[model samples]
Target: MNIKQYLDSTYLKTAQQANLTEMENTKVVQHFIQEAIDEDFKLIMIRPDHVKLANDMILKHKSKVLIGTVIDFPNGNSDLEPKLQQAQTAINDHADELDFVINYEAFKNGEITLIKTEIIACAKLALSNKKNIKFIIEVAALSNHQIIQICALIKNTIIANFKEENFANIFVKSSTGFYTTINNLPNGATLETIILMLENSNPLPVKAAGGVRNIDDALTMIQLGVKRIGTSVAKTIADGHVSNENY
Candidate 1:
């Protein structure tokens, strides 16, 4: 299986999070971007701050690797304005894809309108810019029912407001790869959750982010109908090796 095509080789940690100096952290991002270019992975998912760096490298090499950056990151609780602002910046930096963390917390709090509005506004921005967009639902923080509901919500919202051709550009992604779960539970896409997402999202597409560790995991997700897999261990998986990293 040509697993590299389905992988969004990810590195989203900040300097502080990675316990590295700013320069050191940037070096890591640079190395990842170069590796993605060399390995010909589908995309490189990085923090918003590094989109320009990735874009510059891709341009220099005239590579086909796409650039993806996260908006509102691990926490999707931010107000819509902040998310829009962040996404705009990423687009300005020439990011090919924008993955926005949806306000899942509002959905959990019975704020349906808030969640719907955010989806519509942010999605329109990305689509208008001709950029691919993914809504990270953070499945690890939700129940199975919520997962299905949110997936349907995202699917329905896009279908209702956007053209049919635009549907392919939007995706209902599974997680941010940064959520923390109790009792060491899986903090990302599990088989069960991917099934839920696939069954509900339909033509909207699904991206199985987080917890996908190896070739078998990547293959399983693709077989289950996930169009993309966001993982930090893209190289190991591409090499057919199991990754020991939890994410």
Candidate 2:
């Protein structure tokens, strides 16, 4: 089933997070970009700081792999200006997709206006720049009801503010693959949560990220209608082997 095209091979860890020096971390990013090009994966999801690096490598090889970067990262608590600025920089650096971590805490706090404003503004920035946008809801930290509501909120906001033709460029991604849960629970995409996201965010596509470790998991997400799978083991899955690597 040509799974490589459905994968957004991801690496978003920082130097401190990975216990590596800055130069060492950048080498890892470079290797990931090269691997994505060699494997012809659909895209490479990385931190905003590495967007330029990915861009340069892809250009050098004349590869078709797209570049994707996160906007407010694992925590979506930043104000609107910073998020926009980060997204803008990534776009300027040739990122083809911008995955913004939605302000779910605000939603939990009943701050609907704040969340809605960011969604609209970020979506506008991405679409205006002709880049695809994905809103990561960080499912591990949210209840099922919150998952459904946030997905619907993002879908509804995009639909109301943009033309239907642009819907294909927007997505409700599952996670950042960096959330910590109680008792080490699944911090990324799970079948139950993905089902809720798919059903609630219809017509606006879904990218299943986190906890998708092997070929079986990837196939299940695709069968359930996910348009993309974000993982650190894209090559492993593409080669038809189950990876023990934790995303």
Task: Report the CA-based lDDT of candidate 1 relative to the real structure.
Answer: 0.93
Per-residue C-alpha lDDT of model 1 across residues 1-247, encoded as one tens digit per residue: 6789999999999999999999999999999999999999999999999999999999999999999999998898888898999999999999999999988889999899998899999999999999999999999999999999999999998899999999999999998878888999999999999999999999999999989998988998899899999999999999989987877
* Per-candidate TM-score against the hidden true structure: 0.98, 0.98
**Candidate 2, superposed: residue stretches over 4 Å from native:** none
Model 2 TM-score on a 0 to 1 scale: 0.98
Model 1 residue 27 distance off true place after TM-score fit, in angstroms: 0.6
lDDT of 2 by residue, 1-247 (tens): 7899999999999999999999999999999999999999999999988899999999999999999999998899999999999899898899999999998899999999999899999999999999999999999999999998999899899888899999999999999988888887889899999999999999999999988888999999999999999999999999888887667
lDDT of each: 0.93, 0.93
Predicted structure 1: clash tally? 0
Instruction: Give the lowest summed-lDDT range of ten residues in model 1.
Output: 238-247
